[model samples]
Target: MKTFLFRSLFGTFFGAFVAVVTTISIIYFGSIEQLDSEMFLRNSLGSIFCGWFFSVSPLYFEIDSLKLPTQTALHFITVTICYFVLSLGIGWIPFSFPTILLILGLFLIMYSIIWLCFYLYFKNEAKKLNAEI
Candidate 1:
């Protein structure tokens, strides 16, 4: 439990860092002129909180040895639900079914790509280890 909490703390810090970078990049590059500084700050904090929540929440899942497909699916579902609910709760996204579905679909695609990349990287590393053995 101590280890898990430590991991969660590390993950949350990492996630917040990523979120801050992302927010800065978007504000710098995307250059949304309509949002005031206060609004931007609020959005940035919301994103950081979301990232931290997401990072820490998944420590409870026991899916390390699960099949790749099952693990990916579970992660995708869990993240999507958490993100969607958070977005709605924070008014980051409007509470509309169609919009929610659209965001979910996009998130599914993004998560699938992420899972595939990690899967391939780990599989290759395992194969290399086996070759050495």
Candidate 2:
């Protein structure tokens, strides 16, 4: 219970941090001309939820019956939907067929890179632990 609460709070804070960073990046790149308070608030909240969901997504691996590939695919699909919808709502990506496919392609590439990094790191750590044992 305590760990769950910690993860929840940590996820929320992490989400907020990601949203702020994203806002800064957008401003730095001048992607948008202007952002009124209402839109900013909505986008910030949406981004926070996106980050929170992404952070907690690994919990899906806790399901004993699901293999690693199944967990990975489920997590990927769920987060992709969450991110795609949030991006559309926040105007980060336009609503068009080509643009949609582009965004998804980019997301898949990034997700795969991140997943591989984590997998390799954990695999190394596991090997080290086994060697020590």
Candidate 3:
């Protein structure tokens, strides 16, 4: 019970931090220009909530053996690929190599930081729980 509660709290905090960072990056990069203030806030909150959900989803599986680094890498790759494909489909952004690479690079860096923090927080909590045991 204690372990679960600790993990949940840490995960939530990590998710929120990641979301804030992501939101800031998007705004800084002009990605949120199409969104009004209210929409931006809502999207930011939603993305943060989604991040928490993604972070916790693995718990249902074998989370104990999860390789944080590998998982983070794969997550970044998957997101980048998806965004690239989506941009191509929507024609919202010019499908130029430089633009795609820039967007993917920025997102990858931001998300990597977020995931790294979550992984560290979770690892620390697990260590504490093990010590208690």
Candidate 4:
């Protein structure tokens, strides 16, 4: 839908911007002798596409009144699949068992950390609101 496209487009540009900044930082701080401009451009665009795809995927989680756990589970499953597929397609991740397992493990750790942070943030906000009432 429209919202999906909007989110995807936003992510595409943001991801590309981040990718460029990261590359620039690396190049500024260290030598990237083997990396040519063409390769860099190609990789940047690919990353943008990956980001767009990832963003659009969240549309599946937009159902109203769903339990938090259900929403989280859906998001995790959708994003994992989307990330794996797009990463492999873009040559960011190789198609291999070891690589898949490694990626999944890292994703799991990061996902848990992010969710915990969100939970804590919302809990604090709720406490503040209750105090004001």
Write down the lDDT of every candidate, Cα atoms only.
0.72, 0.85, 0.64, 0.81
Q: Return the lDDT, model 4, position 43.
A: 76
Cα-based RMSD of the predictions, in order? 3.7, 2.6, 7.7, 2.8
lDDT per residue, candidate 3, 1-115, as tens digits? Answer: 5555666667677767876776678778966555466755655555455555555544533454657566556566665565455546545357888987787778778877877
TM-scores of the candidates in the order shown: 0.68, 0.84, 0.47, 0.76
Give the candidate number with the greatest lDDT: 2
What are the per-residue Cα lDDT tens digits for candidate 1 across 10-117?
A: 766776687678767877999955656776666666676666666765543455677756765676677777778777877888889898888878877887787678
Largest TM-score belongs to which candidate?
2
What residue pairs are clashing in model 2?
none
Predict model 4's lDDT versus the native.
0.81
| Tens digits of lDDT, candidate 2, 39-69 | 7798779877876787687788778899999
In candidate 2, where is summed lDDT lowest over 10 consecutive residues? 1-10
Q: List the residue pairs that clash in candidate 4.
A: none
How should the candidates be ordered by TM-score, best one leading?
A: 2, 4, 1, 3
Task: Enumerate residue pairs that collide in model 1.
Answer: none
